[model samples]
Target: MIKHAALVSFLMHLDYFDAGNMDSFVDDLTVIPAGRGTDAAGQIVVCEMEYTGVYGIADYPHVQYPVQRLLAQISAWLLDHDTDRTTPFDFSVNVETNPRDDSKADLEIRIPFREAVTASADAGGELALAGEHYDVNA
Candidate 1:
């Protein structure tokens, strides 16, 4: 979650936004190759997001998200509003799959969308989760 904003900003600066017939930064976007780096808490929500539009894949780019200092704000907003945000999100191309334990998520998303996706599930069953919910308490 913390790296989300930074990643987004970087992508944007690199021209990662869709604008009519303009060139898209990424060919496609989905949730098959990312969504890792989440907390061990129950309740994990995986939202399929993306940033399109870019001139071309640059040779190199510099970016920052200030995860340490800004993560709290993002987390606070989620917690304050009771939103599920256990996974560290970022705009990506193709599809990616994120695991619940965060031990290892197959970072092999080169396609659009994916199967066997993990979702946000709450501990103590207080929050009912869908799909393959990863139990942080476990």
Candidate 2:
């Protein structure tokens, strides 16, 4: 099992356009055409993982729980939407800010799809991601 601290460390060191990680999660996103990177809206897709409310070594225990849950949620979301079971998006992150809260951060994962049609999931034309449970924006 990946510890919260270690996971946090790994996440922090990750780059949005890291080729290795992008290739690994490609299947979780969309299928890429042979030479199609000329979409009107660009070919980059982003997935954001948010972590809010408090931060510290002591919070590691509590922090990890949500992280694991979020990971699972993302997996399910991808499985449900990805028909081709592949995506070529690059991942990124977005860290929010809170005056009252101790910590506020968001992780964004992105992919570059040949077309929006390929990036879409089977959700009746709208990507309503489980009522913002995971906030999956494709």
Q: What is the TM-score of each candidate against the true structure?
A: 0.21, 0.25
Deviation (Å) of 65 in candidate 1: 24
lDDT of each: 0.33, 0.31
The positional error of residue 19 in candidate 1, measured at the CA in angstroms, is 15
Clashes, model 2: 23
- Badly placed stretches (over 4 Å) of model 1 are 1-24, 33-38, 45-128, 131-138
TM-score of 1: 0.21
Model 2, span 46-103: residue lDDT tens: 2322222111222222233444554454445434543333541332222222232343
Worst 10 residues of 2 by lDDT: 52-61
Q: What is candidate 2's local distance difference test score?
A: 0.31
